[model samples]
Every structure is written in structure tokens, then in C-alpha cells.
Target: MIEEIRIENLGVIAGARVELGAGLTAITGETGAGKTMLLTGLGLLLGGRADAAVVRAGATSASAEGVFLVEPGSPAAERALEAGAELDDGALTALRTVAAAGRSRAFLGGRTVPQSVLAELAEHLVTVHGQADQVRLRSAARQRSALDAFAGPTHGRLLEDYRAAWTERQRLTVELAELVDSAQERVREAELLRLGLVEVERVDPQPGEDLELAQEAERLGHAEDLRQAAQVAHDALMGTDDAQAPPGAAALTDLARRTLEVVARHDEALGALAGRLADVGYVLDDLAADLARYADEVQADPGRLAAVQDRRAALGTLTRAHGGTVDDVLAWASTAGLRLVELEQGDDRTAELRARLEDLTGDLQALADQISSGRAEAAERLGAAVTQELAGLAMASATFSVRLTPTPELGPWGAEDVEMLLAAHAGAPVLPLGQGASGGELSRVMLAIEVALATAPSSARPPTFVFDEVDAGVGGRAAVEVGRRLAELARGGAQVLVVTHLAQVAAFADRHVVVAKTEGDVVTTTDVRVVAGPERVAELARMLSGQEDSATALQHAAELLERSAVGR
Candidate 1:
């Protein structure tokens, strides 16, 4: 139930704050009493699209806000989360503002939101029916939606699963189609990758091999000069009679031995000299062995050199173009291998696709059956309830039926088509609702449906239903019956707001709000007030007899209230 609604500078409503409660709330007045303006304000609050013309003549902007108490895990909360919105506990406060400059804004739970959020919130908030809703009933989509709504939780889950699988299948089919349609293009691409990968495989370079090879080539190129210098040093170190000869490995060893021989003669000094000569001999011997190895290994094989050069050149080509590393080439090869396989094996891909199609179709059929069965059960119960509602609205002779027709072809929804059929009087012959919904009969039919489904709200406080012109052409007994029906619908839950000129309808209200127009210097204003107790009687009497002082009208108004109390 809507707890409160406030409007400012919107159409004929300059400023108004209407506090609402659980059960039926009737707003009534004379012709041009701004009853429709109140509904317009409500529409704006519910996040309806706006026109700047709604702003008052002297105002730059129009604003509307509503507060509702919702259940903790209601559909409204789920919708909020789905839309990436946050709610304040279980309560919701929605505000919408429209500027004369053609700009509009919406706020939910104090955070700014897109108009789309408002549209979603409105689903759980209110179900407003003017003449527009009657026309919507003729649509197949609306009928389908109604059927789905009537379906219980089992059908709901099945429809959800079916939709999920259907979407997955659609996505897979699109990808498969793209891959198949571009087969020739894929062939060209595969050819290009194969050439690149083959070149890389031919080389088969290892990690860091290119850098190591570069270093080796530089060292080999300097081998000749290194060998010449090493030979000269060897000759100097081993010269037998040369003065100032550099001591070779053998000479150093002999000097160490001579020092050690005098170890017994010259105690400390000779011992130290011997140890130092021993260290020098060790270093000299190690150096001589390394030099010999270097000289021996400096091979001058031109053929081997040519082969190394050719290999290096081939590797360098790939390195410079792709990356200066063999690892990069390996990565490219791995990627291309998968593509090549896909391009070469078309039959295997088709087989996999056929298998996938079978699985998806099977899943869809199971889900559809679940949905259909649940809907069958829901339709039975819902049809019975709606039939009872119609009786309360004085349609006792009318026949209402939920017609479920099975379809072989599965659409986005499922394989069942549901329709609501009706007959105005006994033996009138049942017909589609669209054909029979004339002379205000459709409005009452929709009313019955809405009342039955009203409990399925997104919040604990179901939105107040606003019927702008439900009693458009109805009056007297029928009008009274409409009011009684609205009151009856409001019994279990929800706040019903009916804008009408019928006094009998107004008599059924727990609260009767009267809208009066007041003219000022520069602008005209609309004010609404709650008429209670005896004052309510005056309003009802005025609606009844077009005069407030009629004794009969007052007595009838009192009688209506007395009857209303007993029903409650």
C-alpha cells in the first residue's frame, strides 16, 4: 500500500500531500474537479514518462514522490538488485521531477537512478488502468504475460530455465554460423599462420640460444689473435738461457722447493718464503693449463663456420620480425596450431554442433512441459477466483474462462497459448474477451483480473490501484456496485484509489477526498481535503442528489455507510 504521496507544481495540482492507508480510498468531486489531475500526479510518481507541460504555468518544474513499505524479499527488492540498485531495508521511496526545459530525473531510495529503474519499480508498485489497459487486453503478448503471471512458482521457474537455455542456444548458433559462413576467409588465415609456424619449427631455437650464439660468434672471430698472444707468453716463461726470463710453471715450483729446503736453516723467514713460493706455483700451473686448452681448441674449420653462420642468419630473420627470442616464436606457433586444426577439421565441428543442438532442444522441451503443467493448474484456480470477483461487480450472469491452447512451435515464451474468454449474459455464447469487451464491460473484466492478482506485489505494501475513469459512463446501482467491489478487493491488502463522480462509489470509501478548484490572481489552484464522518455524508449526498440539503440523499448516504460498516 502506498503510505504517502506528495505532489508540487504539477498540472492543476499546485501542492498536495495525500496520506493513504490500507483499503479502498475514494477521491471524488464535481466535473472538472481535478480528479484526473490527482491520477496524473500519481502516474508521475510511479516513474511514468513525463511532458514539460505538466508543470504549473508559473512554475519551472514539477515534482512527485511516493513512499511504500515493502517486504524484505519481495519482487521489488529482487528487481532493485538486478538493476544494480540498493534499497533501504524493506522500504522504498521514489521521487520523480520534470522540468519545463524538457529535462527529467528520478530518485530511488535517495540515489539517482535512470528512468528505466522507475519503469521497473512501477511494475511492483502500481497497476494503473485507464482506457489504455482495455486496449492492451487485445494484444497477444499481454495475454501471454497474464498467463505467465497466473502460473505458479513451478511454471515460473520452468519458464526461467527454458529462457536461459534458449538464449544460450541462440548465442552458440550465432557463433557457429559466423565460423561456418567465413570458411574461405578462415582458409586464407590458416594458410598464413601455417607458413609462419613451419618456419619457426624448421629453426627449433631454444630459450636464450640467439644471445648465446652471438657471444660465441664474437669469441670465435677473435680466436686467431688470442692464440698468437698465448704462444709468445709460453715461449717467454720456458726460455732456458734468457736473461731476465719470466719464471714459468716449473721455475716457480723449483724456487718454492729451494725455500722449503732452507726451512731448517733460516727458521721463520725461510718458512714464510716457502709458503709464498708454493702459492705462486699453484697460480702459474693453473694459468698454463688454461692457455694450453685455449690453444688446442681454436679450430679453423671453415665448413663448420659456414654452417653456423647460415643457422644464425635464419634465426635472426625470425627474431627481428617477431621478437628477439625463440620463446616468442613458440608462443605464436602454439596459437596457430589450434587455428590450423579448426580449419582442417570441418566435419568434426559440424558433429559437435549437431550434438549441442540436440541437447538444447531436449532441455527446452522439458522446461516447456514444466511451464505448461504449472500454468494449467494456475489457470484453473485463477479462473475460478476471477469468476467470483465478477459476481461481486454485479456480473453474475457472465461466464469467464481461461482457455489454454497447446502449440507445437516454441516461441520465446513457450509452447502454450493462453486466452481469457467471456460471455456477457447466460447463453450469450462465449467469445474472445476483445470481441465482448465493449460498453464498459472490458473495464470490469480487467478489474476482476487485477483484483485477483493484486496480492502478487513486489512489496508488503501493494501499490494503490488508481482507476482514472473506470466508472466513466456507469452510474446509480452499477456505480455503487463498482465501489463495493473496489472496497472488497482492498480487504485482504492494497490501497484502492478510485476517481469518480459516483456518490455510491464514494459512499464505499473509508476516506472520501474531495478536490475543489480555487482561483487566484495569476493562477488557478486545486486543493484536496479528506471529508470524514458527517462531512463525508454531505459529499455523498451532493454526489447522490446534486444538492447537499436533501433529506432523502442524507438518509441514503447514512444507510450506505451503515451497510459498509456491516460488510467490513
Candidate 2:
């Protein structure tokens, strides 16, 4: 509930503070006395869009602040707390400011916050209805929502379930479609993977096999040249059996050693030289034996060379397609093998998804049927209730109906479209609300619908309700009924604020506030104050007639107030 509202520099409302409490509070003023500004201020506090043009002339900024009282653990309080707002004894302060330069800011519980936070809190705190809403009620979607709201909490839960199932069904439908549409593509992909795997398996390339084979092939190809080189070196190191061959290194070395040995008995230095020559002859003998063994082992084998080349060519085929090396090809095979397993299971996966989608489709159909049934039942009750209310609001002959037309397919809300229809009088053909009802009838119809919805067993009423001239085209007894219903709504444990021009409605209020305007040379200012006793009557009289002092108007205003008191 809103405890108080303070507005400054907004429109012609330079500065005004209005205190509010339980029950009905009526706000009234002359045509241009800034009554609309009061609601605009409230809208700002409720996080409505801000226009710099609303700022008072010569003022730098305009601001609206509201103090709201909420239950300790209410959703509104919890949301405020979540925004780092400090509630003072269950009272939360919301402030909005619009600078003349077009910038806007919002503050909640003394902390700066985005304007959306204020909007979120407003949903739990209050419900504001205006003439604009009466126009909105003509929409089919809006009618459906209103009917759903009146269907009680059980229906609401069922509707939520239906929506959840509907959402899941939609997702499953898309996925199943994709899988089915790409079936042939998936088959082709699996075939390609299978062929690649077969090719790799036939080659059977091992890690580093290509490199090893290359080295072996090179040695085999040069076998004859290697053998010839080894034979020539061996003949040079040791004397060959051929007589034409000159004395080899070994023969020369042995002769030098004997010459040194003969001189060793005559000189000690000659004996050391003979020992070095003997070591050289031993090294030459070892080299010659090694060279002879190498020449005999080096034999060209064409069959082995051809086999190595063939193996290399086979490994090369795998390399060119998959990688630059045999090891790379092996790595590719390992990854492709895993992917092949997945591709091979596509049919199984497709079957599984189709089965799940079938089950989900059945579930959705069941939920939609339940929702349609609930809506049909609730629509009848709500239509009857609102029609009953319309009778009291001076439309005794009018018939209100909530018509549910079955749709070809299920919608987000249900399997039908809801529309509100009305018959203005007996014998008049029933038409949609927008087409059949006049402005006055529409206003009454909107009020009657509100009253009917408020009486729903499972509907949770907001702490506060603001009606901005919802009685726009209503007057006479119809206007009085409007006030009576608003008062009853307030008396049922909620605060009701009605901005009205009708004196009958003003008379029904527990409190009356008048916005008086003062025109200055440079600017216009509005003063908002609560009126009671004769002052309130005078205000009502002024609303009834052009003069507050008119004797007949005052008498009528007093009589209306008396009747309202008795009715209350």
C-alpha cells in the first residue's frame, strides 16, 4: 500500500504531498487544475516512462517519490531487498527524477537502481487501471488472460503445466524434423567414413615404418658400389694373392720394424722406433680383416629391395590422403575410428528421438485438452459474473459473454481463442465488446469485469489499486455504481485511489483530495490537499456545477454524500 506520495516540479504540480491509507481516496480537480499530473507523478513512482517536457517551467528537474507499506515477507519486499533496498519498518521508498535535459534516474529504498526494478516491485505492490486499459481489454489475448486470471489458482497451475509441455513439444518437434530431414545426408556421411576406414586398414601402416623402409632401400640400391670400395681398401692395407699387386702397407711396415730391431742392439733410440712400427703393422692387419668381411656381406638382393619399395608405396598412399607421414596417418585413423562409431549409431539415435517426441506430443495434447476444458468452465462463470455486475452499473439489459472459439491448432495459451462479447440491449445482436458497446458502456463493462475478477476465489488482489478516470464516459447512477464498487474493493482490505471528475464518485470516497491551481505571471502551480466536512462538499458542489457556492449544487452534493454514507 502507498503510504504517501510527494511530487515536485512535475507539470503544474510544483510541490505537493498526499497522504493515503486504507479504503477509497478520491482525487478531484478542475479540468486543467493538474489532476492528470497527480497520476503522472504516481506513474513515475511506478516506473513509467519519463518525459522532460513534464517538468515545470523554469525548473531544472521534476521528481516523484512514493512511500509504500508492504508485508514483511511479501514478494514486493523480497524484490526490494534483492535490489539492496533497505526497507524502513516495512516501508519502501521509491523515487524517480526526470531532468529537463531529458535524463532520468530512479532510486529505491535510498539506493540508486535501474528503473526496471521499480517496475518489478510495482507488479506486486499495485494494479493501476485507466481509460487506456479499457481499450486494451478489447484485445483477444487480453481477454484470454483476464479469463484465465478468474479461473482460480488450480487452473493457473494447470495452465503453467500446459505451457511447459507445449514449450518442450515445440523443441522436440524442431529436433525431430532436423534428424528426419538429414537422414540421407547422415547415411552418405557414414558410407564415406566406412570407405576411409577400409583403405587405412588395408595399408596397415606402422609408426615410423616409411622412414625405416627408405633407409633400407637406399643401402640395398648401392650394394655393388659399397662392396667394390671395401675390396680396394682391403688390398691396399694387406698384400693380395695377385703377384702384380705391389707390396701392401703390412709388408712395408714389417720390413721397417726388422731394420729398427737390427740397430736396437747398437742404439736404445732405435729399439723404441722398432716398437712403434710393430704397433702400426697390427692396426693395418685389423683394418684389412674388417674390410674383407664388409665386402663379402655387401650383396644386392633385388627381391628384398622390390619388397621394400612396394611397402613404401603402400604407406605413401595412406600418407597422401591423410597426412605427410605414416605416424600422421595412424593418428588420423584413430580419430576417424571414433567418429565412425558415432555415425554408425545415427539410426539408433534417430529412433530414440522419434520415440521421445511421440511421447511428448501425446503429453502436450493431454495438457491442451485439460486447459481447454478449464477455460470453458471459467469463461462461463466469469461472463455470468461480469454480466451480473453490469446490471448494477446501469446496464440491466446488457448481456456479457466470454466466447471461446476453437482454433485449428494449439496456441501458447490453449487450444481456443477467447473474446469478450456484449449485447447492448434486448433484441440487439451480440457483437464483440469493442463493436457493440459505446464509450460509456465500455467503461462500465471494464469496471464490472474488474469487480468480477476481484471476487474470484483464487485471485490475489494487490495492496493498492489506482483507477485513472476509468469512469470516463459514465455518469448518473452508473457513475455512482462505479464509485460504490471501487469503495467496496477498497473496504475489502486494499487501498483504492480514484481520479475522477464525477461528483457522485467523489461523494463515495472515505477521503477527498482536491488539486487547486494558481496561475502566476511566469508559471502555474498546483496545490494538493485533503478536504473534509464542508470543504469536501464545496469541492463536490463545484464539480457538480460551475460555482462552489451554488445553493442547489451544494444541497445535491450533501444529499449524495449522505446517501453514500448510508450505503457504506
Candidate 3:
């Protein structure tokens, strides 16, 4: 619900503030007293297109701000919070400014925001209807939604189930298409993986086998040189059997140790030197044995070297194809093997998906049928109810109906397109809403539809409803009915503001605001104020006649107010 509206530099409004609350509010004034400007300001707050021409003369800019009371966890409140807006105790402030130079800006709940954000939030906040601002229920989709909402909670659940099935069917259809389209590609991929795995298994390379084989091959390639070197070193370490041969390293070290031992009886330092020489002698003996064994073991085998080289060449092929090393080749082979299995299962998976899709198709058809049935039943009742409302709104001869046209194929909404049709009077052909009524009739038609929908058990109502001269061509008893219905709509916990010139309609408002124009030396300004008692009577009197001081008009206005109060 809107708590207040503030306007500045907008047309003849200059600066004005209108405090609003629950129930019906009537804005009435003289022909040029700026009543339209109030609704235009409201349009700005609703994120309507900004025009620099609407700014007051000599003013730099025009601004409109609205304070709305929203539920704490409602979608509008959540959206404002998401945009980093700070709501003051569940009251959201929406402001729009248009500069004379054509620049425009919007703010929501104290935070600057994109104009589209305000438009999006408006869906949950207000519904505006007028000769030029018929925004709600303008499309087939929205009409279908409104009808579905009127169908009650059971039908709503059925629609939800159908939607869920439709979503799943769409997902499955896309998945199946992908699998079928990529069938040939998967076959090619599987063949490549199979060939790579075959090569790896044929080589049978083990982890670290390539490096070990390379080392063995290197030793075998130079076996003769290695054996000769080892034999020479062995002979030097251990003395040769020939008596003329010089003493080997072990024998020389042992001789030095004995020499030191004899002299060490007189010196402790010499004894330590002898112990070191003894340790060196033991190391030389061990080295001579190891060298002799190495020389014997180091025999050149051409056949073994050839076999090792062949194995290395085969493993090299595997490494080059799959990886850089024997271990990497093995790892790649393991992963490829798994992929090959998955690729081989593609046909089976495709068959399963086809079967599941077929089943889902059947399910979707049944659900669509059920939804269409429910909609058809609801459409009849809704049409009758709205037609009944039109009679009271002075369209007694009119006939209204909801037409459901079946589509050739299923759509997101269902198997049918929902449209509202109207015939202006008896013997007239029924036509779509906009084509069948005049601007004034269309506004009444919209109002009747709203009142009819409000009677539905599951209808979701917007917080505020704005009607701009919806009573334009309506008068007499019909005008009182229009006022009664507007008040009735507001009584259902909605804030309704109607721009009206009819004293009959304005008299029924819970709060009546009169826009009074004041002429100054250089400029004309309009002041807006809530009127009651004599002031309200005078305003209604002015509406009934051209003169507020006319006693007959005053009496008539007073009687109309009394009648409205009793009807309320």
C-alpha cells in the first residue's frame, strides 16, 4: 500500500504532497486544476517514460516519490534488499527524477537503481488502469495466468505438476538429441582409444623399466673396456704373484702401520698414526676383492645387448604415442581403457533414453489434457461472473466470454491459447477486448474484470489500484454503482485511487482530495489537500454544478454523500 506521494516541479503541480492510506481515495478538481498531473507523477514513480516537457516552466527538473508499505519478506522487499536498498521498517521509497534537459534517474528505498528495476517492482506494488495506461492483462500469457489464478488452489497444483513434467520432458529431449547427433563422433573416439590401448598392452612396459634397461644396455655396450679397467685396478690393489712386482696398496699400508707401531712405544701421537694406517689397509683389501669380482662378472654378450635394445625401442614407441615415460604410458592406458568402455555403452544408453522419452511424452499429454480441462471449466465461470459485473457498471446488454483456442502443438503454457472476448451489445459479434470497446468502455470493462476476479477464492490482489477517469462516460445510478464497486474493491484490503470528475464517485471515497488551482502574478500553481465536511461538500458541489455556493447543488452533493455512506 502506498503511504504517501510527493511531487515537485511537475507541470502545474509545482510542489505538492498527498498523504494516502488504505481504502478508496478520490482525486477531484476543476478541468485545468492539474488532476492529470497527479496521475502522471504516479506514472513516473511506476517507472514510466520520462519526458522533459512535463517539467514545470522555468523549473530545472521534475521529481516524483512514493512511499509504499510492503510486507517484510515479500518479493518486492526481497528484490529491494538484493539491490542494496535499505527499507525503513518495511516501508520502501521509490523516487524518479526527470531533468528539463532529458536526463532521468530512479531510486528505490534510498538506493540508486536502474529504471527497469522500478518497473519490475511495480508488478507487485500497483496496477494502473486508464484510457492510455491499460498495462495489466494485456497479453495472452498474462490472461491465462489471471484465469489460472482464479481457478482456485487445486487447479493451481495441477498446473504446477504439468509444468514440472514439461520441464523434465524438455531436458530429456535435449539430452537425447545430443546423444544422437554425437553418435558418429563417439564411435571414432572409441576406435582411437582402442588402438592406443592395444599398443600399450603389446609393449607391456613396467614402471621405471625404461630407465633400468637403458642403464643395463650402456654397461653391456662397453663391457670389454670396463673389465680391462677393473682388472688393472685389482692388480694394483692386491700385489701380483710375480716376485719382482711392486707392493700393492694394501701391502704398503700394512708395512707403514707396523713401522709406526714399533716407534709408537715411545710416542702416543705415533700410535694414533699407526691406527689410521691399519684402517686404510683394511679398506684397500676390500676394494681389491670387489674389483676382482667385477672383472669376472663383466662379460660382453652381443645377443643380450641386442635384445635389450629391441625392448627399449619398442617401449620408446609406446612412450611417444601416449606419454613421455613408461609410467606415464601405463597411466594413459588405464584411463583410455575406462573411456573405451563408456564409449562402447553409448548405444545402450541411447536406447534407454529413447524409452524414457517415450514414457514422458505420454505423461505430458495426460497432464496437458487435465490442465486444459480445468481451464475450460474455470473460463466459463469467470466469463459469466465478469459479464454479470458489466451489467451493474452500465453495460447491461454486453456479453463477455473467455475463448480458448487449441494449438497444433503443445506450448509452455499448455495446449491452448486463452483470450478474453467481448460483444458490446445484443446482436453484435464478440471481439477481443481492445477492439470491442471504446476507451471509456474499456476502463469500465477492466474494472468489472477486476471486481469479478476479486470474487475468486484464490485471486492474488495487488497492493494498490489506480483508475484514471474510469467513470468518464458513466453517470446516474451506474455512476453510484461504479463508486460502490471501487469502494468495495478497496474494502478487500487494497489502496484504490481514482481520478474522477463525477460527484457521485468522489462522494463514496473514504478520503476525498480536492486539487485547487491558484493564480499568481506570474505563475499558476495547484495545491492538493484532503477535504472533509464543508470543504468536501463544496468540492462535490462544484463538481455537480459550476458554483460551490449554490444551495441546490450543495443539497444535492450532501444527499449523494449520504447515499454513498449508506451504500458503504
Candidate 4:
């Protein structure tokens, strides 16, 4: 519910504030006293289109601010919190500003927000019914929406089930058609994979075999050169053909060790040096044996070398076509094998999808039937409830009915077409609501429907309702009945604000606000003030007889107020 509204530089309302609460709050003023400006401010708060012309002259911009008491954990609070907005003391502040240059801005809970966010929040916060809304109610789509809202959860659940089945059937049909259309492409892909797999299997390359073969081929190609080098090294280390080779290195080291051992009794340092030479002689002997073994093993074999080179060339083909190495190529072959299976079974998969599509089609038809039945049942109860409400609104002989005509083709909603028709009086032929009801009757019918929807067990009633001049053509007892119903609707815990010129309707408000305008030489300003007690009675007197000081008008206004208070 809106706790307060502060508007500046909007229309004739230079600066004004309105305090609201749960129950009926009526806005009244002279026709040109800026009564509509109050509703305009509300419209701006709800993300309505911003008009530069509405900005007061000489003002840079016009702004409207509202403080709403949001229920904890409600959708309104959640949306505000999602936008990084803080809920202070369980109240959300929404503000909208329209500059004279046509720029518009919206703020929610102290955070700048898109105008659309305000609109999304408004869906759950308030429902505004004005003279224009009645025209909208005449539409077929609107009629369907009202009926569906009245139908409650049973119709809602059935509609959802039908839409789900319909969506799945559409998906399956599309997939099956795509598979059939791309049959040739699938076959081409399968054949490519088949040929690649065959070549990889035939060669059967080993992991890292290419690197091993390259090293072996290099060794075999230089076998003779390696043998010659090893023989020269062996001769130098052991004994050569020439005897004057200084007895090779090993004999010299052994002679040095014997010389040191003979002098060991004379010097201890000499004995240590002789021990190091003995160790060197053993290492030289081991090196000579290894060189001889290497020279014997190094033999050239052209046949084996050529076979290794040929196998390497074959493995290179697979690597270059598929990957950089043998292992990478093998990995590709493994994945391709799985894909080959899917491509080969394309026809089987297509058949499976077709069967699924057929099954979904049947399921969708059944669900559509259920939805149609639910709507049909709801249409009867909704018509009776609304007609009963209309009788109380001073249309005693009027009758309302909902007609559901089944169509051959199914739709997302159902196979039934919903239409609301009315009989204005006895012996009158039923006609569409737009053609049968006059402007005043239309107002009453819409009010009845709104009340019914608001009171529905399944409906999440909006916290506020703004009715702008909805009682345009209504007067006398009809106007009083409208007031009574508005008060009744408010008693159910909603903040109802009705903008009306009738004193009867205004008397029913728990709080009354009057917009008074004063025309100055260069500027006109309007202020909204809360009226009560004798002040409210005077305002109502002006509404009754265009004379606030008249004794008779005062008496009538007081009587109306007393009657409304007693009725409540």
C-alpha cells in the first residue's frame, strides 16, 4: 500500500503530498482544480509515458515520488532487493522525474533503475482502473484474461500442462525433419571416418616408434666410422704396433706406483701419491675393455636399416593426416570411431524421434481437452458471480454469461474460444459486452469483475486500486451503490482510491483529499490537502449543490456521510 505521494512541477500540482492508508480514500475537487493531476502523479510512479508538456512552466523538471509499505518476502520487495535497492523499515521508495527537455529518470529504493523495473514492480503493487480501462475491457483478449483470472488455479495448471506438451511436440517434429533432410550429409561424414579408421588400423603404429626409429637409423648409417674411432682409442689406451709408445699410459702408471712403494719407508707423503696412481691404472684397464667391445659390436646392416626407414615413412603418413605424433593420431581415431557409430545409425535415430513426436501429439491433445473442460466449468461460475454483482450495482434485470465455443484446431491456451456476452434486460437478445452495455453499465460491470477477481481465493490481490472517474455517467442510487461497493472492496484490506465528483461516493472514503487551485497573474498552483470533520462536510456540500455555505446542501452531505458510516 502507498503510504504517501510527493509530486513537484507536475501538471497544475506545483508541489503537493498525499498520505494514504488501507481502506477507501476518495479524491475530490472542482473539475478544473487539478483532481486528475493526483492520478497523473501515480501514473508516473507506475512507469507511464512521461510528457514534457505536463511539466509546470519555468520548472526544469517534474518529479513524482511514492513511499510504499511492502510486505516482507513479497514479489515487490524481492524485485527491489534484486536491483541492489535497500528496503528501509519495510518501505520501498519509488521516484520518477521527467525533464522539460524530454529526459526521464526512475529511482527505486535510493537506487537508479530502469523505468521498466518500476513497471514490473507495479504489476504486483497496484491496479489502476480508469475510464480508458473500461474501453480495454471490451476487447476479446481482455475478456479472455478476465475469465482466466476468475478461473483460478485449476485452469492455470491445465493451461501450463497443455503448453508444455505442445512445446515438446513441436521440438520433436523439428528434430525429426532436420534428421531426414540432412541424410546425405550424415552418410558423407560416416564414409570419411570409415576410410581414416581403416588406414590407421592397417598400419597399427606404436606410440613414440617414430623417434626410436630415427635414432636407430642414424646409428646404423655411421656404423663403419664408429668402428674405426673405437679401434684407435683401444690401441692408444692398451698397446699399439710400435713398441716405443712409452709402454702406453697403463704401464707408466704401474711403474710410478712401484717407485712410490719402494720409497714408502722413507716418506709417508710419497706413499699417498702412489695409492692415487694405482687407482688410475684400474680405471684405464676398464676403458680399454669397453672400447674393444664397442668396436666388435659396430657392424653395418643395409637390409635392416632400409626396413626401419620404410616403416617410419608409413607411420609419418598417419601422423601428418591426423595429428603431429603417433599417439595424437591414435587418439583421433578412437573418437572418430564413436562418431562413426552415430552417423551409421541415423535412420534408426530418426525413427525414434518420429515415434516420440507421435506420442507427444497425443499427449498434447489430451491436455488441451483438460484445459478446455476446466475453462468451461470456470466460465459458468464466473458468469453467475459477476451477474449477481451487477444486480446489486442497480442493474436488477441485467444478465451476464460467458460463451466458450470449441474450435477444431488446438492452441497454446486450448481449443475453446472464450467470449463474454450480456443481456441488458429481460427478452433482450444476448450480445457482446461492448455492444450491449452503456458507458455507465460498462463501468459497473468492470467494477464487479474487478471485485470478484480481487476476492478470489487464488488471486494475489494488489495492495492498491486507483479508479479514475469510473463513475462518470452514474448518479443517484447507482452512484451510492458504487460507493458502497467501493467501500466493501476496501474493507477486504486493499487501499482503494476513487476519483469522483459525486458527494455520495466521496462520503464513503475513510480519508478525503481535496485539490484546490488558485490562479495567479503569471502562474497557477494547485495544492492537495486532507479534509476531515466539518471541512470534509463543506467539501461534500460544494459537490452536492455547488454551494458549501448552503444549509440544505450541508444537511444532505451530513446525511450521506452518516448513511455510509452506518452501512460500513
Each candidate's lDDT (Cα)?
0.76, 0.88, 0.87, 0.88
Root-mean-square deviation of each candidate, in angstroms? 6.9, 7.1, 5.6, 5.5
lDDT of 1 by residue, 40-153 (tens): 877876767799998888889988888777766778777766666566666678788999998999887777888888787777778788878888887777877776776645
Candidate 4 lDDT: 0.88
Candidates ranked by lDDT, best first? 2, 4, 3, 1
Task: Provide the global lDDT of candidate 2 against the true structure.
Answer: 0.88
Counting clashing residue pairs in each candidate, in order, gives: 3, 0, 0, 0
lDDT (tens digit, per residue) of candidate 2 on 1-568:
8999898889877888889988999999888788888889989888899999999889999999999999999999999999999999989999999999999999999999999999898888888899899889999888998998898878889888888888887887787788789889978887887888899888888789999999999989999999999999998888789898798989999999998898799988889999999999999999999999999999999999999999999888889998999999989888988887877777788788888878877877888888889899998999899999888888999999998999998788878999999998888899998898889899989888887887777877677888999999888889998888888878877788999999989899999989888765111333688899999989999999978999999999999999999878
* TM agreement with the true structure for every prediction: 0.73, 0.79, 0.76, 0.75
- What alpha-carbon RMSD in Å does predicted model 1 have with respect to the real structure? 6.9
The order by descending TM-score is 2, 3, 4, 1
Question: lDDT at 60 for candidate 4?
Answer: 98
Q: List the residue pairs that clash in candidate 3.
A: none
Model 2 lowest lDDT segment of ten: 518-527
Candidate 2 residue spans exceeding 4 A from truth:
50-61, 99-103, 204-335, 520-526
Candidate 4 C-alpha lDDT tens digits along 40-66: 889899888899999988899999999
Looking at candidate 4, the ten consecutive residues that score lowest on lDDT are: 518-527
Most accurate candidate by TM-score: 2
